[model samples]
Target: MDDARPPRARHRPGAERWFRPPDEERRGPAGTRPPWLSTLLVTAVVLIGSGFAGRNQPQRVPLDHVGYALLCAGGVLLLFRHRFPRTVTCGTAAMTAGYLAAGYPYGPVFAITALGVFAGIVGGHRRVAWAALGGLWLSHLVLAHWLYAWLPPAHDHAAPWGQELIVTAWAVAVVAVSELVRVRREQLAKVRAERAAAARRRADEERLRIARELHDVLAHSISVINVQAGVGLALLDDDPEQARTALTTIKAASKEALGEVRHVLDTLRAPGDAPRSPAPGLDRLPELTEQAKGAGLAVDVTTEGGHTALPPGTDLAAFRIVQEALTNIVRHSGSRTARVLLRYGPRSLEIGVDDDGPATTGQGEPAGGGNGLVGMRERAAALGGTVEAGPRADGGFRVRARIPLAAPPGRATGTDTVTPDATEEES
Candidate 1:
């Protein structure tokens, strides 16, 4: 037996509208329908349906067919709006206002009207949209109460005040939703800009870290080898006994440099799996001076006050300050002797390195490109420390640095020496 439902309630055999996909749904952009065309189509559907219902009504306003014609034209113009939003919105608003004045009497054409205004809010300048909305409100009030006095009843007169309140509330609702969408778009743009800036900062910092590590590893090892090579070449004709000791220093320095490079590479590859042994810290100052002495520079070290444990970053900064200073001496100073002083205090630690090298003067200053000083300053600044380098008043060149005893993460330790607890601190 056939189902005993009403024919309208049943899925009728010939009602094809439900089964056929909308042209917009079938052929539009993946997620969004073209705004102008979508607005036009929606208005057309409302207009045509309303026109059929009102066909037999008397035409109280002028040029009834002309009003319908303008609406149809306006709707068609709206279809291209997304490609040209401002122009389409302006045209639609002008035409729709005219239709309302001509007594088209609020058909489904209002849907297209609302969409055009929303498009203006979304795509046009805030001032323009505000001006347009204000003008629309004035027009609506004039038409409903003044020009069409005998036509439809005014909103506040015929309907209860609550009805007027409902219409006003809905207008506010529309504007609120549109503003929310605008704010979200701006926020997304801001987030993207911040992300791009952060990426650039990380790239620059990584490059600097790599350069500093290379400097530390190569400068010490190379300086040692250079010193030993000089000794070996000189002793070739003289005392071969001392020459053997120089060669051993060269071999040991090379091996240590290689190990340091490997350590840095491993840390870069998997920081979590990096060896427990840390980078050289401030406590290694004695060793650094001895290494320089082995390279033929007589160095003196002085430490003042009972040594307090330094923060890891601060310790590293202290070490780098000393290292860079010694490296600078190796490169520029023509002197054979240097002094390193480490002063520890309650709040901070100070390091100073000076050499009695020949004063750099005459033909255009020593041309070592001044980057050693820059690297030293950068190291100190990273740990909230400050560095000063210049010619000493006592006819020598000095590199001095001050590093904070402690700092938060992501801050510079003012040294390459990253210290942690007591274990790594000793090394």
Candidate 2:
């Protein structure tokens, strides 16, 4: 038994008009709502307006069944303008030209053709719209001037040369309007795309910033806590007093780490609120040295030149760079001592940390693809500066950063540099 309903339609390659799948509706037309409503409105205007126009143009053909059918066809073609703009444009132009060739009175019927051309141009089918509309205009020119004498409803003489100029002006107006709308639509689309791209870039930068801040805060504090915990465990079995001191250091380090982490994370919870505390700066050098001492690493901080206050960004970056460098020394260096040199230049600040060493017995190099070194370099670079790290030919490791200060710090004055054991170096 042969069972069949209507035959299933086979979609031909490159034939857009023959297929309308489910996805076509979900995707919308060119990422916008379809123009079906406008098409229907224009179709109504064409039929109603041409009936009136037919009464005024007695020499032209009246609105008969054929004329109405051609006008409706011109409007129907526009329904697919957004999806297949070039196709709709050619189809509408052909239908309009046929209606004109039959000498049907011209009115809003031309609007259907113009709308198709507009959609084609705006949908990025520029050359096709231009070619179709031009062909339609030239076809009208020929029929009105040369063929009207024999083709229409009775004695219609040749149209005047001046009337041809009006037709030329009308065609120019249609093209100009279409071109302007196309350009404006593209500009709006470009602006929207740029805003979306900018938003994505900002989100990426924010995530990176948060990551860097958390790593800096936790790495130094956690390293100090790790060493203190080890010391406490080793001492608890023998020296109760030393074990108590190690526990105290661990508590302080843990408390400080929690505070800094909270500060960094608070920005995510309440972005517009003022910080709970001021960001750490180089003025806190004494605290850093004391923390290093807890981890059995001595840090000598020597300041040269004017020690004037720095911009908030520069100050915070300098403090973090030094903090991370000393933390690395504590974690990776066998050396028990480190030196931190802070030199204040007229327009920039230079920071250096060095430790005399061979690589810690079995521990490898520290700066190989480590986030600590990368974070230091990134901090310096953000301030329009540079960071250099390597083994000093004199038999030690060195990390130095030079950060430009846009606002020049004031003149140098005599001051004392703080040493690890509370000793002072006069500047």
Candidate 3:
């Protein structure tokens, strides 16, 4: 049941190439037909059409045949209007003037000539086109007068003047439409190019931001592993049992770091990959509070209003804000007690983290010089939210973030929490 057929030859040996010259060696003589033969074909059509229209004119001139020939040739050159507008226009103008002066039948033939001249002028120059229009009208006026006088029946001379005005207006209309099309095309191209460039710039910035995040995540975790390993090595010679415990902590930390690294790498490898794991959210504050406690920081968690699950971005922002705030406490706060309060309200969620540690006593010495606060602010700002951090009035540092609970733009929620922690004026 084979239905396949043999392929046929695409070309004949002796015939000219369908679209190209047969003589591969003969690059035609200079000024001969161009590689784009279509241009030549179009020129032939324009010339022949205009020529036949002109040849049929019943006009009596001493060199009527010569005028007709020149008109046909000029029409052919006019086909190059877009390519060499000025040259074609000037040549066509000369030929048309010659045809009119040779006493062609004025009405129908003059109309065709006027159209050709109009094309040339629009393609050439606006001022020149208008000037040519005026000149042609004057010529027609004079010719009409001659015809009126020569004909047996009297003809109205005013009639020809009105006709001249109408033709001139048509020429002006053509010029306006052509210029409008050209201008619109240029504007469209510019807008498209600008938009494309802007998109590319945004993509590059996103990539750079991702790179920075990956570096931050790796550096922080790896640094912790390094410090723990060093401590374990030092203790190994003195207290083997304690060293083993530190080694176990190191193993756990390294494994967690490897998972985070793999998640980041996989995201980079396949852009369409799903979320690695749900990002930490406000509901996980208890776990975070415990982690801080484990790291030897005393923390108190307070809730005000009944809490509800939040939008993913808002939840993530709240969690990170608290995490960074706690990290700062451990790193900078020499205090034994820190407090985290989550306040959920009708419009927004307010998070406040504070530590009653005495301020570090130096300029440019971050009580914990770092980007923790900066990270918190950035996360909030991305969600049309805001955050503030400064030393508390009484004594200590405080960090607060406000995240809107309103679902981001196009989402709906039916069963979300209604209230947040309501603690005020704590001692």
Write model 3 residue lDDT over 258-363, tens digit each, in one string.
7766765666666555656765477777766655554456789898897887877677667767776776665566676789999889888899998887754321
Residue pairs clashing, model 2: none
For model 3, give the 10-residue run with minimal summed lDDT. Answer: 418-427
Tally clashes: model 1.
Answer: 11
* Backbone clashes under 3 angstroms, per model: 11, 0, 10
Top candidate (lDDT)? 2
Model 2: per-residue Cα lDDT over 1-427, one tens digit each: 0011222234333533322222444376656455677778889988999999999988788889999889888877777787888899999999999998898897888888888888787777889998998999899888988888778756888777898787778778888988876676566446546766665654555666667778878989999999999999999989999999999999999999999999887765665577678888888889989999999998888989988889877888899889988888887777889999999999899999999865563223432535777677766766667787767676678988998877224311111111111121100
Cα lDDT of model 2 overall?
0.77
Question: Regarding lDDT, does 1 or 2 come out ahead?
Answer: 2
What would the TM-scores of all predictions be? Answer: 0.70, 0.85, 0.63
Tell me the RMSD of model 1 versus the true structure.
13.5
lDDT of 1 by residue, 277-296 (tens): 68778777777777787788
Deviating ranges (above 4 Å) for candidate 2: 1-33, 361-367, 407-427
Residue 139 lDDT in model 1?
A: 69
Q: lDDT of each structure?
A: 0.64, 0.77, 0.56
Residue 197 C-alpha lDDT in model 1: 64
RMSD of each: 13.5, 12.5, 12.2
